[model samples]
Each structure stands twice: as structure tokens, then as C-alpha cells.
Target: MTERSNQSVRRAFKLVDELAENGPRGVSELADQLDMPVSTVHDYLQALIATGYVTKDESAYKTTTRFLEVGHRQCHRLEVFKAVRDELETVAEETGEHATLLIEEDDQAVIVAVQEGPDAINLFAYPGARMPLHATAPGKAMLAHMPTERVTDIIDRHGLVEVTPQTVTDPDVLFDQLEDVRSQGYAIDVGERIAGMVCIAAPILDKNDRIRGAICVCGPRSRLDEDRRSEIADVAQRAANVTQVNLDYV
Candidate 1:
């Protein structure tokens, strides 16, 4: 590809992704993230704005609602996304906690869909958030369901890095926890990803019993206490099953 063709699309996508993750940003910030000159980023933003994909607000630029309009159309066309969305919403409604769908991607766990519950606590993972496979409840659930070789590949690629004080960083401990997830049919994250937050996750398995993805319910520790742990877990498991069934996974 020529410089003009490759540079514009690549830089535009970087700006769009950065904006998607952290709202409107200044040209300098976008330039710094893309490792390009501010003038270059500003030029790209001008092109994007002209095309109606991005908008400018004084000194900052943000992706326009055009992306949302396209996203709504795309979501309907993606069968797996359509299949799990209802169950994800149901889990959030039933548990009164954040419900999310996560799938392993490029050796990382990718948050693909989410629904927030009535109460809001701070676990900043949103749709398109990429997290370490060994550092999250949904990641562990899906990992436990995967074949041993694939599990090892993921662990090898993304080591058990600590995200919080309670995060299991030791390889041995993480392996043991994976074993427990296999036996228990659910995975738990007690302040593992974020302090004072608890998460329960269950894997949606395919017809071959391979993990397709996982469903998770998250909330503050006080709300997701021992008294309601099983209840939340059961709801998450049922949601996962619902997704599998929708996919025609026997």
C-alpha cells in the first residue's frame, strides 16, 4: 500500500479506537498515542470529520453517533452477539450486577458485550476492553473449559500478572484455581481484577464441550457476599447455558 492510502486508514482507526476507549481527546493526546506529529493527527481528524465519522468539540475530537448507527446494524447481523445479548441482560436484571460476555482473542480475553445493573461500582472494563486471560473471572472460566494445550499457550503468552492485591500471580496458585473452576463449573474473582470487587463467571460451551465464551456477573464485595454467591453463580451459569442453546450447541 502507498503512504497516503495506508497512513490515513491506520491513523484514523487509531484515533477512533482511542476515542472509543476514553472519550474526547485533544490533538496532542491523539498524536502522542499514535506516535505521530500533532499536525498529522489534526489533518487526519479533519478528514474523518469531513466524512462524518468523527466530530470536534473546541479542542477535542470524538467519534460521532455514526459509529453507533453502524454498530446497531452490525450487532443484529452477528449471530453470536445477538444470541448472548438477551441472556446477558437477563443476568444483569436477575443479579442486579454488571453482566458481560468475554471471549479469548489473540491470547487475551476480550470483553465483547456488557449490561450494567442498577447499582454502579468501579470495574472499568467495558465492551472492547482487553484483559489478561489469567487475571479475570470470565477469562478463567473460559480457560478452564479450553483444552490443556490452548490453556498453556494462553498462560505462556500472557503470564499471570497481578492486577490487584488479591490477584493470583503465582503460576501454581493460578493453575490450582483453574482446576477448581473445572470441578465447580464456575469461576470466582474475589477482588482479583479490582479492589473490593467480586465477579462470578460461567463458560458457554460448544457442541464439542469447548468454550465458546463466558458470561460474568460483577459487583462490589458487600453485595456479592457469601449469602448471595451461589445465587449469583447459578444465574450466571444459566445465562451461559442459554447462550449455548441459542447457538444450537447440544
Candidate 2:
């Protein structure tokens, strides 16, 4: 592609991302935020509208639900997601906590499915939520099973940013903890990503022991004492195992 066309593509995607994140916006507002000229923003918005990816209401332009269609199609294409969809609900109901399925993409953990038990705490996590792989139990669970080179690459790309006081920000410390995860067959998060929250996760592996993704249960620390954490860990691991088995039959 020509340099001009490539720049135009990047600008167009940026405009769509801004609209998706911030909701409806006017031409001047988008131009100001993207540091582009008003006419350019207008032209991009017009092209997006023509492609049915965006819509305008009066003077404000917003992304259309067409994006949801695209995301939905992409999500279902993952075999692991389909295998674990119903199992996550079972984990949540069994543990009375939040259950989530996460897969690594672009060096980040993306939530593919989530379920809340009757007594589950609200963590504001939903499908498609992306988080650093070093900051959450499921992310760690998946990372622990990956090759050392891949893990190092991910750490190099996105440093171990401290999300909370408990987050491991040192590469050596994280590698040591990953060793524990491999031996124990599960990963733990104690107020790492968010204060007062605790999580336990297990990696799902294929027949060849390749890491597919992870399943986790999360709850408030007050509700997840040491004993309770152990119980949830067992449950999460069993859920992950079931998903792994289902992957073979499906």
C-alpha cells in the first residue's frame, strides 16, 4: 500500500476506535481528539457511514451495532470459547463467585466468556474485556504454560505494570511465580489487579498439552479466605479440565 493510503487506513481505524470508546461525537470533537483536521475527520466519518460501520444522529457520529456482529462472529470462531461457554456458568454457580474464560491475544488476556453466581461480586468484567497478562490469575495461568521465549516476548512488549500494590512488577519474580503455577496446576491472584479481590485460575490444555486458554473464579477477599480459596481453586481446575476434555469431543 502507498504511504498515504496506509496513513489513511490508520486514521480511519483510529476514528472508529475513538467513537467506539467515547460514544457519539461531533466532527470537531473527533478531529480535536485525533489531532487531525476537521475535513479529514468528516471524510473518514462519511466513508465509515457508507460502509455501515458508523451512523450519524443529527450532528453527532457514532459507531453502529455492526461492530457487534463482527465481534460476535469472531468470538464464535474460537473452539475453546465454544467448549467453555457453558462450563463457566457451572463454575460460577458452584462457587458462588465470578467465573471467567480468558485467552491470550496480542499479548493481552481477553475475556471470552463470563458468568456470575447468585452471590457473585460485581467486578465490572464482561466479554471482550482486555487486561495485561501479568496482572490477573487467568492471565498468569495461561502465561505459565507458554514457552519461556513467548513469555519473555510478552513481558518485553508490555512490561509488568503494577496495577495494585500486590502486582508482581519484576520479571524474575514473575518467572518464579510462574514456576509455582506449573507445579501447582493453578495460579492465584491476591489483590493484584484490584484491591480486596482474589482469584484462582487453571490453564486448559489440548491433548498435546498445549495451552488453549484459562478458566478462573474471582471473589472478594473477605469472602475468599484461605480455605475458600483452596476450594475454589479445585473447582476452577476441574472446570478447566472438563473444558479440555470437551475440546476433544467437539
Candidate 3:
């Protein structure tokens, strides 16, 4: 591509990202936030509107449900997601908590599906949400099953940023915890990502024993004590095993 066309593509995606992240915005507001000229921003907005990816109301421009359509289609296309969708709901229903299926992407955990039970607490989590691998149970569960060299590369790239006061910042400490997770067949999180939240997760492997993703059950700390944690761990592990078995046919 020509340099000019490459720059245009980057700028267009930047505008779309800005709208996706911050909701509707006026032309001048977008220009100021992006440090681009008003006329340039308006031109980009016009192209986006013409393509049906964005819509204008009064003086403000916002993205349309087209983005949702694209995201939904991409998420549903994953083989692991298809295999684990029912099991994720089963986990939540049986545990009375939030259940999630996540996969690693660019060294971060991407939530592919979420199910809530009758007593589940809303963490405002949704599909396509990304979380740091080191601070989440699902992330750690997957990481524990990964090769040591691969895990080291991910940690080196992401640098284990502490998400909460309870987050493990030391690399050595995290390595030790991962060792425990590998042997136990599950991983636990106690306020590591969000304060007062607890989680249990297990890695899901394919027929060849390759890591595909992870399944997790999460809730408030008050509700998941020692006994409850052990129980939920068992539930999560079973769900993960079922998902792995289902993948064998897929």
C-alpha cells in the first residue's frame, strides 16, 4: 500500500476505536481528542457513515450495531467456544456464580462467553473483554499448562502489571504458583484481579492435549469460602473436562 493510503487506514481505525471506547462524539470533540484537524476528522466520519459502520445524530457521531454484528460473528466462529458454550452455562447454574470461557490472545485473556446463575454477582463483564493473564484465574490456568518458555515470553512481553493489591508482581512467585496450578489441575484467584472477588478455573485441552482455553467460576469472597472454593474447583474442573471431551468430536 502507498504511504498515504496506509496512513488513511490507520486514521480511520483510530476514529472507529475512539467512538467504540468513548461512545458518541462530535466532530470537533473527536478532532481534539485525536490531535487531528477538524476537516480531516469530518472527512473520515463521512466515509464511516457512508459505509454504515457509523451514524450521525444531530452534531454527534456514533458507531452502529454493525460493530456488534462483526464481533459476534468472529466470536462464534471459534471452535473452542462452540465446544464449551453449554458447559459454561452448566458451570454457572451448578455453582450459583459467574462462569466464563476465555482464550489467550496477544498475551492477554479474552473472554469468549459468560453465564450468570441466580445468585451471581455482576462484575459488568461481557464477551470480548480482555484481562491480564497473571491476575486472573482463567489466565493462570491456561498459563500453567503452557510450556515454560512460552509462559516466559508472555510474561516478558506483558510484564505482570499488578491489577489489585493482591496481584502477584514478582515473577518468581508467579512461577511457583503456576507450578502448583499445574499439579492441582485448577487455579484459584482471591482478590487478585478485583478486590473481594474469588475465582476457580481449569484449563481445557484438546484431543492432542494442547491448551485451547480455560473455564472459570467466579463470585464474591464472602460467598466462596474454603469449602465452597474446593467445591467450585471440582465443578470447574469437571466442566473443563467435559468441554475437552466435546472438542474431540468437533
Candidate 4:
């Protein structure tokens, strides 16, 4: 595509996202927020309305139910079971801690599934939660399996910003930790993302050996002491392996 075409597409995406976030905006409002001319936004809105992705109501434009359908379809397309929720539930039961499944989406680690553990300790992760790839256990689990170049690119783009005092802020230290994760077949975050919380995660791989996502068990550091780390790690690995086997990716 030409530079102009690419810029137009990017503008359209920004407008749609603004509509989704602000809900039902007029062409002038969208143009003002996007810093584009009203004429350009109107043209894009007309095209989107014609495509049935955006709907016109009186003088305002809002995302149609099509976006909801698209989101559902995207969530359902995961190779995991149609009953993937059950996987987290079982993991929570087995591990007695919060069980979460996070996937790499749009170059970020997104929590796709979550189950409250038996301990009832509140954790921050939930479905739709997004975290940086350099700070969290699930993120590191996925990052370790990616190529070194891709890892460096992501770190360069996102930077190893410290989310907490324990978060790895140095790229070199994070790379060394990734090597350790690769060797151990799992990753750990001890207050790296959230203080006082510890997470153990393992990568979920597809049959073709692609790193599909990650499964994690999270809880207080007190409970996940040296003695229980192996136990939690074993459960996380088992859950990931089972999830990969059962994933029916279309």
C-alpha cells in the first residue's frame, strides 16, 4: 500500500477505537479527537457504515454489534477447548491458587482466562487483563519461547520499565532470566508485576512446536516458598501440556 493509503487505514482504526471507547460520536467529534479533518473522518465513517462495522444513529456514529461478534469469534478461535474455562477451574482446584491463561495478542500478554484459587487471595489478573511482556511470569513464559530477535525487538519497543521494585528493568538481566526460563521450562515472577504476589507459569505449545500461550498459578509469596515452588511448577506444566493437547485450534 502507498504511504497515504497506510495513513488512511491507520486513521480509520484510530477513529473506530475512539468510537468504541467514547461510544456514539459525531464526525466532528471523531475528527477533533483524531486530529484529522471532518471531511476525512466523514468519508471513513461512511465507508465503515457501508461495510456494516459502524452504524449511524441520527447524527452520531457508533460501532455496530458486529464488533461484539468479532470479539466473540476471536476469543472462540483459540485452539483451546470450547470448555476452556473448565481447564482454569481444574487448575485452580489442583493448585489451590489463582489459575490464569494468558496469550500473546497484538504483541502484548493478554489474560484470556482466569479462575479464583481456593485460598481466596485476590490477584489482579482477569480475563482481558493486559500486562507488559517484560514484567510478568506469563509474559516471560511466552517470551522465552520466541526468537531472540523478536524478544529484543519487543524489549526495545516496550522497554523494560519497572512495574515494581522487584521488576526486571535491565534488558540484559531479563534476557538472562529468559535463558533460565528456557532451561527450566517455566517462569516465575516474585513481586515483579505486583508486590507480595508470586506467579509460576509454563508455556503452552501446539503440536507443531509453536508457543501458543501460557498457563500460570499465582498466589502470595508466603505460600509459594521454596518447598512449594516445584509442586506449583509441576502443576503449571501439566496444565499447559493438557491445554495444548486439548486445544482444538481451527
Candidate 3 differs from the real structure by a C-alpha RMSD in angstroms, to one decimal, of 1.2
Candidate 1 residue-wise lDDT, 112-187, digit = tens: 7889878756577666678887888998998887778887776677677888888888878888999999898899
Clash pairs of candidate 2? none
Query: What are the lDDT figures for the candidates, one per model?
Result: 0.84, 0.93, 0.93, 0.86
TM-score of 1: 0.83
- Candidate 2: Cα lDDT at 10: 98
Backbone clashes counted, model 4: 3
lDDT for each residue of candidate 3 in 1-250, tens digit (9 for 90 to 100): 9999999999999999999899999999999999999999999999999999999999899999998888799888988988998888889899999999999988889998999998999898998899999999999998998899999998888798989999999999999999999999999999999999998999999988889999989999999999999999999999999999898877
RMSD of each: 2.9, 1.1, 1.2, 3.6
TM per candidate comes to 0.83, 0.97, 0.96, 0.76
Off by over 4 Å in 1: 1-9, 32-35, 118-125
- Extract clashing residue pairs from model 1: none
Q: Residue 242 of model 1: what lDDT?
A: 82
Ranking by lDDT: 3, 2, 4, 1
lDDT of 2 by residue, 1-250 (tens): 9999999999999999999889999999999999999999999999999999999999999999898888789889999998988889999999999999999999999998889999998899977889989999999999999999999999988799999999999999999999999999999999999899999999999998999999989999999998998899999889899999999987
The best candidate in terms of TM-score: 2
lDDT of 3: 0.93
Model 4 C-alpha lDDT per residue in residues 168-245, reported as the tens digit of each score: 998889999999999999999999988999999999888877888898888888888987989989988887877777
Residue pairs in clash, model 4: 79-247, 79-248, 79-249
